[model samples]
Target: MNSIKPKFINVLFSSRLIEVLEFILEEPKTKKEIEKTLKISTSHLAQVLSKMVDMGLVDKRGDIVKILPKGEFILGVNRVAKGYDEFLSRFGNFMNTYILDDIPEWLISRFYELAEIEIAERREDVFSPHPEFFEHLSNSKRIYGYVTVFFKECINFFLRLAEEGREMEIIVNKGVLDKIVENFTEGFGKGIERKNVRFYVSKKDFQVFFYCYRCFLFDILLFKKCFFLTTRKIFFANLGWVIVPNSKSFIKAIKKYAPDKLEEVIK
Candidate 1:
């Protein structure tokens, strides 16, 4: 008697063929039975069963075909394959509907390309968060900078730290001052408490000229979304500072270059 090898049995485990075998496992069935149960055509079912017979996965007697022990093993592999396919399908749909819905189309295309390039380059330092970056800022006594767009995540994080007694001095673009004023007022609550968060609005385009002492920069250029957040390591070796749209140079340059854009944001 020839010994049945696992390798030979594994060859019959294609996803489509496994579905056919599973139908037979539920009940010993002929080619016609498999065709009706699996919704495969007669010709396709015959071709697959023929291959399985050669691999010792199915035993055929007259019109009836039964799944062998080897066939059962292949069915197990089919279950795993089907499970993985289902998981990926659901996950893909979720990302398409939720996480990606708000993103602009042009940015989406660029983001995907950038992701591929980032994966290929395998640069470890790219977006790896350095706690020391924030630590240095917290230790600094004087901070001078401005921010544009006023990202909520960055503001909230900094505000939480400031509430815990960290001193942070920042300048913001005119476009964001009103909103920041509201957040600062609400965050710290009435009277002199809100004064701790000193904010200035500049008459120039803050986006083009803000600089920080702690030189850290990150750009998120997604479709219809182009923003950069940078922290500069200035002064002390371990201490750094950040700049936003309200930074002195930032305001000065905006006044010189794009003064018209600043008219609405300035105090």
Candidate 2:
């Protein structure tokens, strides 16, 4: 219906309108109830509702404000736009270094599922992970991620998780698999040889590192811990955060990158 035409930009920024529509999306609402629930003054809400009607997004059937089909369309558009906006607002700095090309379209449309993102960074040492991240992660029973940068310590850290009986799956590009076999020759052959740890090698090269546990999803920056692997230039990843702990959004993205399609790395 061309609901996301140029003029829709204004609709995306109308927080009051978004709030009203989201509140009443399932049903209709009375004017007084909206004003009270939104804590908006009568005069302000009057103006907001008036604007909504003028845009043909809503209709006043007596005292109740009802969303029109057009309004539903606008709200849906705003939801997707809001997802991209939130994602960029959080990781915009990585644009120069990383690209989202590896991520597929079906998943990008559902980015809003990642709720309440909180950033946790490691300020003391760029080479190490934040201690608190490890603490929170200890409670998780399963861990899986796509790693582009190969660090023996990082590999060992995850190996320990497997040793402790936590199920582990580490996906990587061929570049990394080669390096692990080449560099950690003796150790890789022995430890990850356990049935608990499974590795996958992707057919495509991915710059963005994606990680998640059963507890939370984490989009991580690479830590500069090795150059022995294929000479792929890597940025130091000293920052990572909980992405809506226990949220389903990242599971989709993690699945998009990992799964039955990739080659399993067998020791």
Candidate 3:
């Protein structure tokens, strides 16, 4: 007879077989005895036992059946698999309830692609910037700053937000401000007056700083090559801005260490 598929047999025989195996290993049982004790029909029990025997999962000698080493291994693996499934089910429910459901919708929609990219990079041991950092910047209704490469994208989005009459305070480094003012002169000429825009010379201190309403604040510290985006609640330092709690302490530390560079544009 053809073998029963492993998938079907795995589900059908797992619980019953484990109990029967434990009982039989304590004392070997004939097919009729196993059927009667387990409350299974003899024909069905025989088919299950036959499949287990054919798969080298059990041993049958004359009328008696006993679990083989292979059957024990399968039992251990199935128990662990069941346990892991339960853990994942609870974990997924926790994330949906306490984490994913609480984030703002606008931030969620705008940064979905960037968030996915960062998650993929994290799996590969690569450094990809977090989307929450940018989302914080994008949603800023007060002072903002941008380096040269980021200036255009920042201004474009900022201008649209301004059209809706959202209050924004913006400060751009002198170098990037010049480029932005030149390229979008007509738009900026009219739009700049409508929004609070500040131009400050590039200083040796911090590169960028902004407050997101009163809930969070950010400061960008540029080093030789890499940059640090620091965030805080109120005004603390050591809080590095990766969207985790406890950023406020980090921000306090950075402010104390580098007061000159970290200018607060918004209260």
Candidate 4:
């Protein structure tokens, strides 16, 4: 009589089989030892061991049971599957907001480096960034940004940083550049002349903001489409900021997306 072949999925899903394989993978063990560690009934253990041996996943030498090379390979695959499962679970909420393509390949590959993600709605608080975001700006020695608008406080912060010898290079909206000149012409004028800060105006209208620093990065996304928050009120859109700490890769990403050599393209 020929030995029956075990269904692969059924054997893979069998808790006792997995538990026994995991244990045996560590070291060869006798049936009595496995029973003591797993607390599985003798009959069930026998059945699972038989199926695994038939599938060429386990080898029994006298009383000692050890996982075969095939079994180790399967376990390695399972380990990878488990890691992806956990990664998906952790970032599921973020996925619901945007499709996979929206995320850059480099960032996606280094998803484990994510420090924080924030979404702020206008209804909740308009133009309000977290306190920590300001701290990052204050401490930065160099700043590069692609920006659309600025709050009064933000402009003031940049001015102070510039005074403290921080170098700022920004690609900004025309209105924002005009506002900075209008509000602080003398200070900004000196900063520009002294090469402490430089601004390039963009012709294309864009609302998203991106900033890169030595060890910090900010990605601020603003939605300004025909979406509505309510029947009477048109949706002003939320700002989604992803803050990354220890941002060497993030700096690279920012440079790639918002090139500093954008003077020729400035309109």
Candidate 5:
């Protein structure tokens, strides 16, 4: 007698499997209810359900079919994988050099959330800040940003925002913070001293940068070694931006890299 092989291939090839899982995602359903709702015959439903059970995807007790934890996990993985694939397709070339591990596993698991992000790139006028970056900054009442590689224009832009009385919280690598203090002494004093702005100097090196505007998450990859939040360094502003319900999650993930008591930069 031959040993039985896993039924994942059968599950993968069957669209009915997804339909069944999704349909039962919220609550358990009866076999007859699934067959009626999905418009599948008794035989077809039987086959899909059997394979789902064998694959540890669902628990079927008589006619009551319920999704197991494994089933829910597979569903989540399927969605995130599609998003990650899309990201890889466009920026996958950099996958070799950039440290994917720099991203927390939770964020990686949620990459699908950013699969269809809006991109803002300033191609024609490379000298100006990214057009969308400016638009968001101008419109936003609040801003949260993390800077990895800095540009003079980017720092100046925030200084101007500070002057406008915009509420802003900034985190930067300690090295970049030093450069700002040394290069822009008077401007830094004026901008940073404002009560509306808060600055934190992170001891850890910036692995990936993000600029959060109006509770939005922004990312732009300049090179394998650098992830720029917003900058005029390349003379063009190209941002990978997304707004999701859990925008705070991205902010929280980045803040974890900072020290328990974030060192405030006093100009």
Candidate 6:
């Protein structure tokens, strides 16, 4: 049997249709119940219901209105669409900081799963979260990420973490890795011999000043700090960090970037 193709764009874009579908999704109700719930006139409610029934989305029996399978499917798609819309609205500022023109829309949409994104402002003379990010790195059992910028303080802590039997797989810029080889070669040697640390240099030219330890992920932007405008750059006092707890969706998103594959590509 051929399934009917619903023209769902109208339902997706129309708030009235979305609202009516949501109400019907909760439970089947009568026309009077929908009219009262939506605070719409009887004529308007009748028109909406009639449109839905003609589209094979709703079935009306006497005074009762029930959503059919087609209606339920449309509702499911709309929910996901709304989720992505909400994400873009809430994180417009955060996402706008990056040049994502080359990134696929599907991958960008998955970023909506990053819940509880936070933005904090810092001044030149005040404390910053660099210490806290490093502290969490030291506390974590395993760490994995790409780092385009290097700090002696952070390298020292990675050494300590390796010595403490923590596992780390890091991809760093050539210059950053060179600095580590110069300053921490002995520590890196010990870490490598113990099989607790592995490092690779990025083949492509790009900056990666961030960290990921277990469920916690951080990004440091490279913009300078100003007294007036908030900056998204890392390696500066005014930095923005995006942290997300472990969720299946989040894990799937990180995996798409294929940090592991990047590791092999470098070697």
Which candidate order results from sorting by lDDT in descending order? 5, 2, 6, 4, 1, 3
Mind giving the per-residue lDDT tens digits that candidate 4 earns over 1-267? 998876576655566777888999988999999998899888988888888899999998778898999898777666555555665775565456545454544444444333223332333124555656676766666665555445656666667777788766556666667778788878777666546665566554445344343333344222221111111211112233333434434435444656652442221
TM-score per candidate, in order? 0.29, 0.46, 0.32, 0.44, 0.42, 0.44
What is each predicted model's overall lDDT from 0 to 1? 0.50, 0.61, 0.49, 0.58, 0.62, 0.59
Candidate ranking (TM-score, best to worst): 2, 4, 6, 5, 3, 1
Return the clash pairs for model 2, or none: 222-237
Stretches of candidate 5 exceeding 4 Å from the true structure: 1-13, 96-110, 120-237, 240-267
What are the per-model C-alpha RMSD values against the true structure?
14.5, 12.9, 15.9, 12.5, 13.3, 12.7
Q: Please write out the lDDT profile of model 5 over residues 73-183, one tens digit for every residue.
A: 888766655676776786676557555554545545444565543343322233234546665666767776555455666678778989999877677666667778888
Q: Candidate 1 — which residues are off by over 4 angstroms?
A: 1-13, 88-267
lDDT of 5: 0.62
Predicted candidate 6 versus true structure: per-residue lDDT over 145-175, tens digit per residue: 5544456666677677778887666656566
Q: Residue 23 in model 3: shift from native, Å?
A: 3.4
Per residue, candidate 2 scores C-alpha lDDT tens digits across 1-267 of 656668667888989889998888899999999989999999998899998999898998889999999999998888778787887887566566555553434334444565344343323234455445465457667665555545555666665677788766666677777878897777777767788766667666644344332332344322322111011222222223232334333344444535543665574
TM for candidate 3 is 0.32
**Number of clashing pairs per prediction, in order:** 20, 1, 16, 0, 1, 7
lDDT of 4: 0.58
Q: Candidate 3, which segments miss by more than 4 Å at Cα?
A: 1-14, 95-267
The candidate that achieves the highest TM-score relative to the unseen native structure: 2
Better of 3 and 4 by lDDT: 4
Error of 5 at 46 (Å): 1.1
| Local lDDT at 133 for model 1 | 43
